[model samples]
Target chain A: MEFGPHLLLATLEGLVQASVLTLTALGLSLVFGVMRVVNVAHGEFYMLGAVLAWFVTSMIGGSAAIGFMAALIIAPLLVGLLAALADWLVLRRIDYDPERTIVATIGLLYIIQQVTLMTYGPDAHPVAPPFNTRLALPWFEFTDGGLSMYWPWGLSTTSYKLFVIAAAIVTLLALWMLMAKSKLGLILRATQLDGETAQAFGIPVEKVYALVFGMGAALAALGAVLVVPIQQAHYLMGDDPLLLSFIVVIIGGLGSLRGTVVAAILIGMSDGIISVFFTPTLAKILATLLVAMVLVYRPNGLFGAKPA
Target chain B: MKSKTLLSAAPTRRNVLTGLAAAGAATALPNFARYAHAGSDAPIKIGFQVHRTGIGAAYGRWYERTTNAAAKVINDAGGINGRPIGIVAEDDGTDPKRGAEVLEKFANQHGCDIAYGTLFSHVVIGSAPRAAELKLPYFVVSEGHHVASGMLNRYTLQPGITDVKSQVQAMAPFVADNLGKKVTMIYPDFAFGHNHRDFFSEAIAAQGGEVIAKLAIPPTETSFTKYFPQIPRETEVIYHVMVGPSVLTFVKELGEFFGPSHPEIFGFIDSLEAVDFASPGLEFLEGTHFWEGMPRYAQSNQTDADKFYRAAIGIDDKGASLDDPKDVSTYAHMFGCWETLYTIKDGMEASGYKGPADRQSLIEAVEAITDMPEGREHPQGAKLFNGKTHQVFGPQYISKVEGGKLVVQHTTSIEDGLYPDEVDYTAQSF
Candidate 1:
């Protein structure tokens, strides 16, 4: 493969990765933004969503399309409800204390993982995509005669991958609307700004916190459901996504949605592009190094507000 | 004898208490009385160090099932030296540090006669030193080069499975002659992968083939399409071997990247060990070849030994669990657990193993084992055990995917997998 086609393929792969990362990081950012509680169990919620997608699809087996459509709706909703239950049972008792909640969520992480292991077993089971077709991408080249376009070997993406990217965009937009243009959003924002003041103003602060936490986990679950067709559902699958999402959230600016999306694109793209020029292991090292540099220079992150 | 007679005749309070204690022990363990007539009533405890909770859990599940089945077979026919085989299993969590701790627990805490059934190479490498330190004979089913390469201590033996160095080298002749010679290798970036890279490269070079490119994917990578571009255009074959939860994704993405046209692909079945062939994107793998330790799908020429082994493990002809068709067993690798358990039985019987005091003799007995004929005991095939290097040599199978089933294409001779010994483990002190 020529350099042009290679770069093009890498960029496309990066975009697909960035799309999933954006949704996952957005969820992490949302939780920290509103509840002021770092949910270490967020990734397990994502894993649960994928596992549930497999369960739902297998049970409702008619066609891949029908089962997948059903899973898209059911898995996230169930995950959201579970997250709300966890918040009510555990997070509420901790009074959303930052350090204690982190520990609590970590405990929640192990509990969810072990329970899933017992129920789902240890195999990595794949859920078929609703639809998948290989689309061979054409690469442009300048010849002596004129500019030409030809399908380069091994330069292609699947129909399902494109769907994942589009679905992530639509979901992120809806999340934006929910946060920016709704009365519930306004209530949530008020609670986020000052819990005691919002409670005094009859905002139902605890209910808002629980709702925010659920939505955050639901967003992650949504991302997981979309990606499950591409990546199999395994209990340990959550570890990589959790680490990557954390890195994206930190680099994007702790609580900023726009920053999270931008940082996801940056990180995901850099990972893909660097692999083209270097070994995959070196690329990972470089990506982590970039995160370190960013942390050192910008303690508040790119879009994080200075501590009050 | 005189003391025993005196104690029984006197029938004092202490004697009565001792008799009651013996009765309680016999009642609590019913098999105690059955085995007492033969010899020592206590069962031979073999500690199972399993990867029950981490990345290796998928393999661990099948390994446990196979181990249990092998133990039942051994005990039903009268166990090692007439004592029933007792498995004391502990989860290693697939982490090296946890693996070492598990070995300690097996030795001191559980009082196991020997530790066995570690799969991951890193875990075996980490825990084997501790096995040596505790003088516990560690029999690993892990097909890593760590044992044969002389990296591990004398106590650590791989008597069940052939190491990666031998397996990789054995496939070279078929690959160079049948699959094209200009190979591009893609493997995980780790010691296991490095072993494949180095050994295969040398073996292929000996066959007048060259490795065009070597692409090492990071262990944590979930998606792999971007790396496909790095495969040289002139490459005639792509040799890939990957392990982990994301392997399905890796294979699927490779299929999607190449579309209808690609190089002849050869891979280790480790990439799809517990995965089903009927997976969505795996349709593209219909014609590719894989090097299987043991054929996953039962062949038309399948041996009676294989049929018996599969039946014992409760796996169907397709290698899935009998209870659930979707739950595929790690057929290619899990045979090691079955064979290793039997090897332990053979060693104990030969050494006349009585307790932990006989651990050294048991190790010596196993080191003397060489020819293992295909039978109810050694089911995979006839194997030639290297008593010196502490690894086994067996025929390797190459299978091609035809109609979503792996059909055996070629079987290399046991001599094809034999390599010069790197270490004489028997020469080292126990």
Candidate 2:
């Protein structure tokens, strides 16, 4: 009801948005950065994650906790495997040329979307949250004696939403560790630096490319599985996430994971807050304008390495 | 598969007689004896302009199934005018340009005697002009107010189902009286949603209620919690009518945003048409009410006619297949396609239609249809065909979710949904 509570509610919403956006853009950034492949079907992978979540939950047939936990683990693995298969079958055949890959992934987008439609049917199905306990946030008011905490009406949020934020942080940290600390990370970084040199050194550069591609898609699926409880899974749900991820990735700098995370937060927070305070249409217009300004001022993006 | 086999294996004489009986013929059945000789061996081609691959694809699937089932019944019992009825289906892709293109294909290429089975309002609005220009009798099952409002020509008729204007008008009073006076509407930002936004406001206003906040979300929006914050805190009833592929999200998000302590909710069943009520996270909707064109879950008082039709189409009492519960049918809107085909049959027989030359006679014959009683042919419910406006007026059901099943709580009479004639289609020259 008061300014502080409303702002807090808005911030909470923004945090949820930022969390999902980070995972989605991370996937897009990883693919482009490591594999040099622009996967236009990244959003479809996100949708597939949600659909697969629904399928897994339905098949498991138990309480929300069990189903959700299964989905969190299984959906991403399945999506990553599917993405790797797609790369092996289609992208490898075309040799992963930038222009051809874009067109091919677009085709993949439609193929995945249509297949999901045919199999899943065009109905939106909801996945229940494992837990959704509402905890009313207390707002402090300065009185004559001292500051007193009062529970603000309509300022409460579900525990499940908070869990989503927490889960995303853990996932992002784990991803960073994998990229920075592991042997696979060294090979991937080497390939990203110079694919021909890495290949000459017997790093199995092609295998790294496939792994990166799968990892990227798996991150998207992870995001989708987390958010699917809050959102329904449908065939056409991929388009918006796709557009938003592209916007975040471009602003963050293509292939720049750090930049991608930063841009996703910026865009997601602004989107949530502005859509609440003003209108959803205005938020979208402002985001698009920000993209244009970023392109004009910094062509390579905020975290992008300078071109050779 | 089991349901289909069981239905097919049932006694043919019983099915045919029950079907004829279910087609509540308050008006006399057409004397097809004379017209039977006109095309004894020919097949009468009816073009089905279906939305097989877009936002309306879910509805399109059920619409196609209903159309096929109806055609099968018609052919089983001596087809229209003794000639076997054939459906020539063209997928409009649910795009406006594609809709017009499909209409042209139907008239110029397919040589269909009539164009039928369009459900999406936008597609119907887009393709109507082309149908008029081509002089093809277009029978739309869409619920948009365009046809009754005289925006379309005489060739385009919506004689099977009521439009949004009439539906909202009937539903508003029940929503206002039983629910709350201060309503907040959350709808998809499109012509169909606009119809709800406008008509519901007007209807509620007439009942001394006011719509406090109106939130129009992009149809493609996946998440909806951001939009929920826009609804003013003072809002009483939340009126939602969301469409597209992400309706489950729209509903689940609302529940999450206001767990157990939100405003009373009234939604168009379009939001959950193909969705299972027992699905996880939908328990919040247990007591909420939805406006249905036709009651999805069969009520205890369901007529024998409705039961017979459900069996005829292989749908269970739950509005899904007895064979597979997950393959749920769009129970509300698909009935329009089945009933529309029957109207076409009755109109053709009444007009003694021989071929395309008798198109005008066919239009006049349909306009002559004043009443459709509750029977096999009019299984959705009894409807009054306004020969003047070329739209049907039918009963609208308001159902409440109880124990994860939709229980019909109120049934508004056909007269409750009627308005003064918007335009006289018969006055408009062919």
Candidate 3:
């Protein structure tokens, strides 16, 4: 069937949604990139961010507008601190075994999710969208490539979606600048490139590693804050996105930030479209097959560098 | 030990200080939180293998609240057979494996007179054999029929009628009487939806109608816009066989169609409960009909039994009498657990002197019951056991969505349907 306006709308939604995915995947890729810790529990961090965002917003935001911004800003930072704490308490003394670490994180994931559930209770907390209306697809063209016909005869984009896309772009750009342009960025790269060498240079590589993990935690929270408007904050909501991020990281080549971004948009679009056609179960089957094919055929993803 | 003696909670401080002001309740009353052994001085412990956490948590939270409240009301009236109902609640978390675990714990560890309640059909089905195995009287408030009927070891009994045939019974008669049309079925491709498709077609055909078209969609298909045209325009009714967010999405898309010049749509009333049919503006569902065997508490069900329902539920401090059937249905469904405890008490009374209320004897008493002690006294009401499959069947009611609420206005008379025994519900087109 030919892709209709709904399809276009779905794709636009997917892209903005992909921004959140890429943001989280970037953090996941960073963790895997440096420590070689599989971080199977990366999604739990995202869930923690969402849960924190939900509770804090419930306390802070008297209204939807205030809640939206407060959650977006504070959720990630708060989660970052929490992530650092988790590292201190658990991961700091964890076994160096990769599979064991993965298994431990998985355990941590369930424990964290269950604890959140026990606290917040299991009902889905609704986070209202910042924008009031859909900017129709047949209106003015957006710089972000979404045609807002839900708008009047002319409007660049639906303000809400445009804000999300802008946020995503700003997040990616800020991450790039932080990694490439800042002193912390330099330390991170140095540690990632050669941990023992960086330590020999008296760089305090342990501090760098901890900080990098915290930043990863912040990104996961940021992703949750952005996602609240679309899906509403739920405990299990992070699982799907978490699995997708794993796919993106693996597809982009583990530890590759740019690779994750490219892979996210493609994966998001495929998932969004296929899910519209089939049930989520079927879409998952297709996604699994796609990931398997990529692993077999490409070995590394399209933009991924060959493994050592 | 997540609160040992989980059958019921430690009574709230409010209930403890201010004893229930019993209003014309009989000697055989229910003992809620206070005075567990008031009835026979021998504690009648009823076990509840319920969902406290997990996916079913949404329903489970309300279920526990209402059931516990009902037990409180029953206690206020009088303890069952002069024995206060001691409840041991266990959290199954809506998992079948977990349900079995809790059922085992409930029967063996807690030594319950009967296992009272479960929400999910899968949980009910999984726990039925165990109920028969340990011979614990398992009372269910689910839509599935397989939990009862089929070669029952006289332990499990559903208070509600079968879902598939009952769903068809509610709609097909309405279709034949009102519209004189057979509907095109667009169901989710699953055992649940397929059961509806197979039965509804036969039900519709039995009424001088032929099935026009049938299309199966994915189980969780949210978008149904493109697939709208897949059902030929020739069909009169577009019966949606889906639930949850999928139903909401499907209806929203169907609202966009504005075709068949008032296309008749049909489905289960359970779908109505999950959805906010009022907003997202389902004026599209206006004048639409669906099957609802369980009537609203106060509006339709105004019998002596309903007094307990009204008192137990509808406690809005805003001073509005709770008429919302959704809330009351949740209350009543859980109330079945309350009544089920009393039924076990009746069985114990019939079985003569009980030591600790053995599981095998309790199940035997439940199976041997000609009618549930608390079952409908009306000729055309829900029958607890019909001696055929040791299951329950009730009159089905048709609900119409009017002015943002699904109110059960009309009800179907009695029908002879020995589902679990005469028909293998599982073997049907799933």
Candidate 4:
């Protein structure tokens, strides 16, 4: 393939990856923003979503479309409820203490992983996409006669991949609206700003914290449900998303949603683009190196607020 | 005068006590010998180092099932040396560090006569040194060339399955002549993948074919479409072999990237071992060929031994679990566990293995084994065990996907997979 088509394909692949990363990072950022708690089990919740999707789809077998549609709604909702339960049972007792919460969530991670292993077994199960069709992409080239467009070999994306990208965008948009325009958003924000003050003002602070944690996990679950059609749901699948989400959240400025989305795009696109120029392993090393450089220069992160 | 008085006073009571004690010792002596004799009849403990928790868990699940099934069969037929086969399994977590620890637990803690059943080359490599140090006969089902490459010690033997070097070399003739001459190789960037890359490259060149490009995907990669662009346009065939949870995604993305038009595709069944062929995006793989260690789907010409083996493991003709059709077994690889367990039985019987003290003789017995014929014992196929290199040579199966089923296209003879010995493990000291 020519350089133009190759870059074009890489960008498209990067965009799909960025779409999922944006949703996952947004969840991690939201939790840290609202509750100041780093939920180490966040990725397990994502894995739970994918696993539940498989369960739901398999149980409600009919047409692939019907099963998928059902999974889209049920998986995330179930994952959200589970996360809320974990918050109530464990995180609530810890009083959302930062260090203790991290440890608690790590414990929660192992519990969820082991339970899933016992129930779902140790195989990677694929969920059928509602619909999938290969769409061959055409690349533009300048010729002696005139500008021409031709379909390049291996330059294509699936319909399901495009759906994942679009679904993530709509979900992220709804999340933005929930945060920026709702009364619940206002209550959550007030609690985030000053928990004691919000409690004094009768904001039900604990309830708000539980809700925020659940919402954060629900967002990640949503991302996972969309990607499950492309990537099979395995217990260990959560590890990569968790690591990538952390890198995105850290590079984007701890709790800044806009920064998280931007950083996701930057990291995700670079992952694809760099692989085009170098080996995939070298590309991963370079990306990790970039994160290190950013950490050294900007301790507060790209969009993180300076210390008061 | 004082001693005489004390002796007279206690002599009656002491004589009675001494007579009772002597009678008790004489009675207990016969019983002690009988108990010692019964101890020798205890089950021969084979410590199974399993990957029950980590990345290899999928393979581990089937490996365990096959091991148990093989053990049951051996025991039912009056086990090795009249002692029942006792499998003492411990999870290695698929990590090399944990693997070594598991081996120690097997040697000292479990008091296993021999340690067996470790897959994943890294885990096998990590734990083999400890097996040598402990003088444990470590029989690995892992098809890694590490054993044959002389990287592991004499105690580590691979008598169940053919190694990657031999398997890869065997595929070259069929791939070059039938599939295509100009190949584009895509494999995981690890030792296992490097084995495929190096061995197949050499083997293909010998057949007057050349590899046009080699795209080594990082093991951590989930999506693979972007890498598809790097495949040279002039490539006649794409040879891919991937392992891990994301393999289905890799194959699916490869299908979506090419859509309708693409070069001939040849791959190792490791990419789709536990995965179902009826998966959504895998429809594009309808005509691609795969190198299977053993045919996943039962063939029309399937041997009676294969039928028996499949029945023993509770796998259906399609290679899925008998209880659940959707849960596919790692048919191509899990056969190693079955065949290896039987090989252990054969070795133990031949060595007249009685206890851990006979472990060296057991290893020696296995090292002398060669030319295993297909039967109820060696089920997958006839194998030629290279006692010197501590690896097995067997026929390699190449199957093509037809109507969402793998149909065997070619079966290479045992000689096709024979390679020169890299190490004389038999010469090494126990």
Model 1 per-residue lDDT at A10:
81
Please give each candidate's TM-score.
Answer: 0.93, 0.90, 0.78, 0.93
Q: After superposing candidate 4 on the true structure, give the runs of residues whose Cα lies further than 4 Å from its correct spot.
A: B1-38
Shift of residue B76 alpha carbon in model 4, Å: 0.9
- Model 4 over residues A61-121: C-alpha lDDT tens digits? 9999999999999998989888988899999998999999999999999999999988997
Pairs of residues at least 3 apart in sequence or in different chains that clash in candidate 1: none
The docking quality of candidate 4, as DockQ, is 0.56
TM-score of structure candidate 2: 0.90
- Give the per-residue lDDT of model 3 (tens digit) for A1-308: 22354466556656766778888898899887777677777888887787777777768757778887888878888888877776666776773358777777788888878988888766555455556443444534456767643432111124566677789899899989988899888888888888889999999866666677778878988887876655456676667768888888878878778888888877776776665455456666876777888899987776667776
Query: Mind giving the per-residue lDDT tens digits that candidate 4 earns over B158-248?
Result: 9999999899888899999898899999998877888889999999999999999999987657778878888999999999999887888
Per-residue lDDT over B222-270 for candidate 3, one digit per residue giving the tens place of the 0 to 100 score: 3454455445556777677554223544665466444325467775654
Clashes of each: 0, 6, 26, 0
Query: Residue-wise lDDT of candidate 1 within A149-220, one digit each (tens)?
Result: 899999888899899989999998888898899988888778778889999999888888778888888888
- Give the least accurate 10-residue stretch of model 2 chain B, judged by summed lDDT: B27-36
Pairs with steric clashes in candidate 2: B22-B375, B22-B376, B23-B375, B23-B376, B23-B377, B24-B375
Q: Which scores higher on DockQ, 1 or 2? A: 1
- What's the TM-score of candidate 2 when only chain A is evaluated? 0.98
- With candidate 2 superimposed using the best TM-score fit, by how many Å does residue B278's alpha carbon deviate from the native? 1.7
Task: Rate residue A185 of model 2 by lDDT.
Answer: 82
Task: Write down the worst ten-residue block by lDDT for model 3 chain B.
Answer: B325-334
